[model samples]
Every structure is written in structure tokens, then in C-alpha cells.
Target: MDLSRPRCRLWRELVLVASLLACGIRQASSQIYITPDSLIGVERYSSSLAIENAPEDVQEYSWHRGANDTEENLIISYNATSHSRRDGPMYSGRESVSIRGTLRIWRSQLNDTGNYTVRVDTINDTQRATGWLEILELEIPQISVNTTSVVDGEDAVAATCYTNDSHVQWYVNHAPVSSNYRMTISPDNKTLIIRMFSRFDSPLQCGIEILPELIQKSDLVYVTVAYGPYSLQLRSSPTDFSGILSAEIGSQVEMECISYSRPESKYRWIHNGSLLSFSEKNITLPSLTWDQMGRYRCIAENSATQLTLYDEVHIQALWRRPVVSRSFTISGSLLVFLIIFTVLGFTHFLMVLIRALFRHYSTRANWSI
Candidate 1:
């Protein structure tokens, strides 16, 4: 072997050894830290935590309630390097050496509320972290009205209240209503239902109160009571048909009569004091003959209230017969006679001319002879 070749191989081996040492040192120096070792909003609940840089084989992990390690609450003993799991009632992850595990607490119940801690152990060193869990029980109850408005005479309207806590009460118009018979509280005590048989036309108030804590009120809803009599009024196109007359017999006539009351109005046609059979919004007679000609009247009435209104129409019959007098007839006859006389006179003159011509012809012949 050549010396330079051996030297180069030795240098390469040294370089490789140095690189390995650097990587080993870096790995050894890298340590896991849990950010925010403590947390709130954990609200008496168990939460998850993230463990970072934990030894690849973390055999045992411990959890406790207090800062002193003496009182230990061993939650889990697992073998994993970088792992995450729910530690407390609240699901917040922890990665610092502080609290690397979740702490469980009952958020609604005030009992299981306190400081929580978690410790991670890797054969050589142990890391610890802590967090606190709080409890809140105040919650607003939900209130709802069945209907925004109720018709008059309608009764037993239901209003409902919902909440997280079981203790709930019902109220109407700011007064506490008994939750015994008319009002009912759900078994969970979270929902309160109230029913009232109300006749007042004014708006009624309803609300729900979570026992000793939260109260929610519903907006007022009105009830309408309707009572009225049907009334009729004749609404003619020309409200005043005072001077209208002599309408063509065959023309379409319109007479409008509308009921100004809740129910619709009924109408009947009357002509010359006789009640006609057909009735409608607009009365139309196809062809108004002489028999059907007379003073027409429209009677609009509300059957319920017996209220009636009348609209009269005067229709003049169309006289289509020829109206000529005796004098006119005689004059026409005389004119015809005069024309005949003139024609006869012209014929007679022509005949005379023919006869004269014939006589002249005969005389000329005699003279020639």
C-alpha cells in the first residue's frame, strides 16, 4: 500500500468519528420542555397533555394533585418516547417537564376541583409540571314561547325553559308560578314548562329561572279576540248614478256591491219591485228585451247582519220600430204619382210624333202622284 493512500484512509476515519460524536452530543443535549406547565379553563375537567423529547422508552409516568411529590396519583405507566394523551377533565395538551399528562376533574361538580400535576420518568431523570382545574355551575336557562300570537278564546299556551342545571322554576309576568300542576319541571331539572289559560287580549309575559342562579325571560306575545257583525255596502263604479239613464238595452251594465264586513256580502237583482233570481258581482243580461226593460235595482245584503243597500239603474228600452206619420206617408205617395204622370206625358208626346210622321209620308205620296 502507498503511504498517501493509508494517510487518506486514516483522515476519513477520523472525520467520521468526529461527526458521530457531534451528533451524539446534540442528541444528548436535546431535552423535552412542557410549555404552559399550568393552565386554566380546565374547569374541573380532565385534559390531555403532549410529551416531547421523552426518552424513547419512557417506562413510567406519574400524576399527583399537589406540588409536593409525596402525594402521588399514578395515572399511567406507559413505555413511549414522544406521546400525547388526555390527562385532565379538560382536553389541553402539556409538553413541558411540568405537567406532561392530563388531569381529570368534574367541571360541573365543585368537588373534584384542585391543582393537578404530572411527572414523566426516563430511567435517569424525571420531569414534572402542574395545572389547575376550576368549576363553574352558573348557566342561563333557555325560554321559548309556543306562538308569537294567539287568537282570542284560545287557551293553555305553553312556554318552555331549558338549561343545563336541573333546578329550574317558571314565572309569568314577573311573578313566580308554581311548578306543581300548571307548571312542570323536567326530571333533569334543566327544563321548565308553563301553561296558562289566558283570556286577556294584552301581551303575556313568561320566563324561566334556574334555581338560585340564572334567569331567562321570554318576550311578550299578544292575543287577538275577534268579534264583529257582517255589514254590506253597495260599492258602485259610479258611486253616484243619480242622473244616468237611457242606456242602450243591449249594452253590458255593471253594478258593484262589496261587503265591508268580515264575511262576504250577498246580492240579488230586483226589477220593478220583483226580486230577480240571478245575483253576482256584476249583473249582466245578455239581451235586454222589452219585457226585461224597467227600473232595475241591485240589493246587496249581509245575511248575518241583515244589512242591505240598494243601487238603482234606469234602463230605457230601444225603440227600433219605424215611426212615420200619416202626413209623411201621404206626401210620399203624391211624389210617386207626380213621377208617374211625368213619365206618361213623355210617352204620349212620342206617340204623337210617330203619328204625324206617318200622315206626312201619306200626303207626300199623293202629291207625287
Candidate 2:
């Protein structure tokens, strides 16, 4: 307590300065140097923090997961002298360290993504390094169209490129797609909407672009256009356009129906005013007779467009009436003799009648001439 002892005061200051130097050295060595690059976790698994520095000077190794090193975030510690390791409660049986000081976490999920740091104590120095674990979204993506098929008109249709957490782009005919007034795409470039479609615009090729420079093409779904059966015509066996087909008695006549349609028209034959059982493009009448001479109609109908057309033809037989079947067995000579005798008898009767009239006239005296 006396001020006379100046040497004692100086000695006290020296001791305090030595203690400060030791503390400065310790603080400088404790400063950790972390790698600027961050680690990336891909898919459903992740990696853990492991001090890869295998220098013989490395006496101790430690790992932590926090902004600043603290007792709570201490994950694992290894002592080189004792050849022993201790794991904190956070990584109890799941965290492991290799003899070369590599930390690994097996079977990691999407949520196991964050910062990690390692503290190393070497023979010459003690320092720390920090890095990060980032899990990249690896969910598979999809591309879909709203309508499987459509009619060519002002109808609306849509397509979409889909993914869970990634951005995607759409392609048309192997090229990148663009949006316009009549056609629009969503802001995320996933949904494509079309207002109207043209006849030539059918079979639009749509696709999707995804990771690994891969492209997925779409199935062929062309828009359907509806039309009709046109240019309907009817032809007979002779293949002429006389409107009348001549057939010998008891002969066969074939008729063909010709037309064009989108989905092909079905043929139906009409005999007279009633429908026939035939439904082929061409028909045949097995036998032709005077009674069968009439008008035959060919009706062409499209099942898809519901368009129908009709044409008819008249059949004429060469014989006016069916040939009569005869059953006579008489000779020519007998037939001539009968004919002459009949004529002679008729002549004799006429002569007798005339003579009687003349005699009557003479009896009356006024007939003297």
C-alpha cells in the first residue's frame, strides 16, 4: 500500500503485459479459415462436414453446425492421441468420422440442408473452416395437353409443362415456343393456350425441355375436321351414263355406287320406293325380268359427318313380255290341210246365200233384168 515501491509497480505491469501477449496469441490461432465454396446436396441424400486435412500436425478435430461455435452446436470431436471420438446428441448414431477426418451423413432427406464448420488443432496452429450444404430439388417433371382431340374451329385448347420446384420451358416442333394474342403462355412458361385452330394447323408438335439437355416429345393428336360425301355417281355393267341399263330376260345386272367422303360413306341400295337389304358400294340383281324393270337408287351416307347423297338408274328389259312356254306337238302338213278346208267351206256358204237372194228378186216381176 506504500508508493515508495516503484520497482514493485513496474514488476506488476510486466506480468500483466505477458498475460495479454499470451491471450493475443491464443485468439489469433483460434481464428478459423472457412472455404468460400458451399457444398451441394442433390436428390434424396446429403453429405456432412468432415475435416479432410490429413496432416500429421493435426492433433484434434471438431465439427459444428451454427453461425458461431457454441457448446450446443458441437456435433463431433476426435482426439488423435487417444484414438477416440465423441458425438453430440444431434448426430448420435447417425454421424460418423473416418480415420482421415471425413464426416458423412447417410440417407439424407430434403430438409437436411444448412451450414457446417470444422475446428482443427494442428501441431503448429489451431484454426476453423466453414461451408454450406445446399440440397438441389431433384423431382421429375411432366408435360401435358388439356384436350386429347379437338374440332378445327374457334374452340380453345391448352398445354402445360409441369415440375415441383424448378422452372421449365416449352418447345413446339423442336423449337422454342412464343406467345401471341391468339395464343398465350403462362408467366411461368408452363401452360400454353390457343384460341382458334385452322385446317392446316392440325398436328401441332409440342414438347418439353428439362435438365441434362433432354427433350420429351408429345404423342400425335391431330385436330379433326368434318366434311361431307361429294361427287356421288351411279354406274351399271356397261359403265355408261345412258340412265337406263338394258338386260336380256332372266339376266344378271350389276350396279355400282361412287362417292367421296371424309370417313368414307356407306352404301345402301333402294329398289323402287322401298329399301333393299344390300349395303355394299356395288350391288347385283341375280335375275332380270319384265317385273323387275324399275328405278334403282344408290344412297351414299357418311357416318362421321352425317352427310348423305343419292342417285338412281332405270333398268329396261329387251323383251316386252316374258317368252311364253309352248307345249304343241303338231306337224306342219296337218296344220296346212286344216287351214285350206276351213277356207273352202266358208266360200261355198257365201255363193249359196247370193243365189237365193237372186231367185227372190226374179219372182217379183219388177226384177226382169
Candidate 3:
């Protein structure tokens, strides 16, 4: 004898006995039975059992309350009867049964989330089947910010959170923030107000968590803050010049003046006594001419601080007018002619004197001989 084979046979026999017991209960009652008559907070409807088979003796079905079951809760109900089969030659005790019924669910609640069962009975047997009902509360509420932009020196800004449900919580950086005196939540329990000390560029996260479930978070929002201008200074390129400053006519000359500050400043170009429209890091004279030749200035204006800066530049004309005086020209010409005539006369006089002396010396020598 194999011990394993005997054990398997015993298990099968036990299963058959249980199935027969379940069927035999239906024979004990003539009616179909259901559980709890009412349901709450349930979104879907279902039953424990769909069909119940009973013997022919069953006529009417009545529902009975079981332990842990209540009235007004959803359940399954039905009615059924059995008929015997007869033949002309012989009559067998074999019977066939037919069942007719309707199923329905009652009032539901959020806490009614659980498993339910239906019991059916006949003259000889009773049977039961199990099912589940689920209730969900999904809702989102309104949220808003107290201030869109915060001041720099301020410790923190506040944002108000709201929701339709009673379960409301505040979150920042995906973590919950303390709802203390610094942060004031609404009395209705639908709003979660928070104040943060740090300045953040990314969006802040806030949300509400209901019991046994999580609701959607509030919309991500960006907070802006305003500050002041840090530093202000002038900058220029090739900042050296010399000589009889001269620049070509009808040519663009660049005069760059740059300023670095926390907040950028506006630039304006001033020529002589007039203000020009060119405002940039570098100011260029589109076309240079004699009329544009003068002192040029670059002024930077910071609207936030109401401050102005000045950078000076000299624009020299390419050509200078020739300076001439009538009196000086006439005097210079006369002086040159007078000097030439005096030198010629002085040379002729010296030659004549030398000749006369030579003739006198020759006559004296002949007389003494």
C-alpha cells in the first residue's frame, strides 16, 4: 500500500463531503437569503452569489440576518423550486430545479468598504458566496498665494492652501511644513497657510492627504522677489588717445562706456549741449563731420537709484583751417627784397676800393726808381 496515494484519496473525499454539505443546506430552506440591506459611500454594486439551487420541496424564500450583518445593507436574494422526472415504464427519484430571482444593492457609505456574503437555503442544503464593495472619496480644492513677490529683507512669504475635504496639509519640497504660529491655517480646516524663510527659484509644492488615501497636490507656483543694484562702475575699450586729435569725416567713431551693476542701467549719449538718442554699451557716431566735432559725453542712468554717470570723449575734426594775417604777409615780402639789394651794393663798393689801392702802389714804386 502507497501512503501518498491513500492521503491524496482522503483529501478528495474530504472535498466531496464539503461540497455536498454546502448543497445540502439549500434543501433545508425553501427561500433565497441576502445580507445587509443598506450600503454607504460605495461607488460600485455587486453580490456574493448569482444563482442558488434547491430541492423541489422549497416554495418560499425568506432572508435572515447573520452575525456581523446589518439591515439596510446590500445583499443578494432569490426563489427556487424542484420538480421530479417520471417515465411510463418506471419512475426514478431524480429531480430537476429552476430558480427565478432579482439582485440589488442599498445605501452606501465611505466606511462600508469591506467584503460581504449572501446565504441561500433549500429543504436540504444551504450555500454562501463572498464579494467586495469599495467606496472612494476623490476631490481637489482651491489654493492661492498671499503675495506673488516678496521683499528681499522679509523673513518669509505666506501662501494659503484650501481643499474641499477636511483633510488638508501643507507641503514644501515634497515635505510637510510646520503649521505653527508663523503659519496660520484657516478655521474651516480647508486652508493650509505656510510661511517660508528661504528664497527659492523653483516652484513650491503644497497638498492635502485624506485618510486612507492621497489627494492631488496644489498647483506649482513661482515666487518672485525684488532687490537693489549691487555695484556701478564705468568700463571702456582702448582707453588711450593723444596727438592733435583728428578723425575722418563721414566715419563712425565708437565710444564705449560699460557699467556693471546688479541691475543694468540705461545709457545716453550727450554731444556738446544736446542729448542724443544713442544709449548702449558703445555709442557710435554714424557719420562724423565738422559740425559734430566737439566734446562728447556718455551718461548712464539707473532708474532704480536715480543716479547718473558721465564719461567724456573729445571729437577732433579731420582738417583745421589755415591761419593767415594780411599785415604779416606784406611785411615779410618787403624785408626779403631790401636784404638782397643791400648785399649787391656792398660787394661792388669793396671791389672798387681794392683796385684803387693796387694802382697807387704801382705808381709809387716807379717814382722811387
Off by over 4 Å in 1: 1-240, 243-245, 303-310, 317-369
Ranking by lDDT: 2, 3, 1
- List ranges where model 2 is wrong by over 4 Å: 1-202, 208-216, 222-227, 260-264, 318-369
TM-score of 3: 0.35
Tens digits of lDDT, candidate 2, 28-47: 33354332224444333435
How well is each residue in 1-369 modelled by candidate 1, as lDDT tens digits? 011111111111111110000111112335543222322221222333333465654645655555533333434333345444324323323212223332222232444346656566677787665544433333444566566443323344555555443445555555665557655656654444445444332444444432222244455544442222224444332233462444455665455555443245567878788987867857665655667666767676655445566667666654476977666345888999989999999999999999999999999999999
The candidate that achieves the highest TM-score relative to the unseen native structure? 2
How close is every model to the real structure, measured as TM-score? 0.30, 0.38, 0.35
Model 3, position 101, has a per-residue lDDT of: 29
lDDT of each: 0.47, 0.62, 0.48
The top-ranked prediction according to lDDT is 2
Worst 10 residues of 2 by lDDT: 14-23
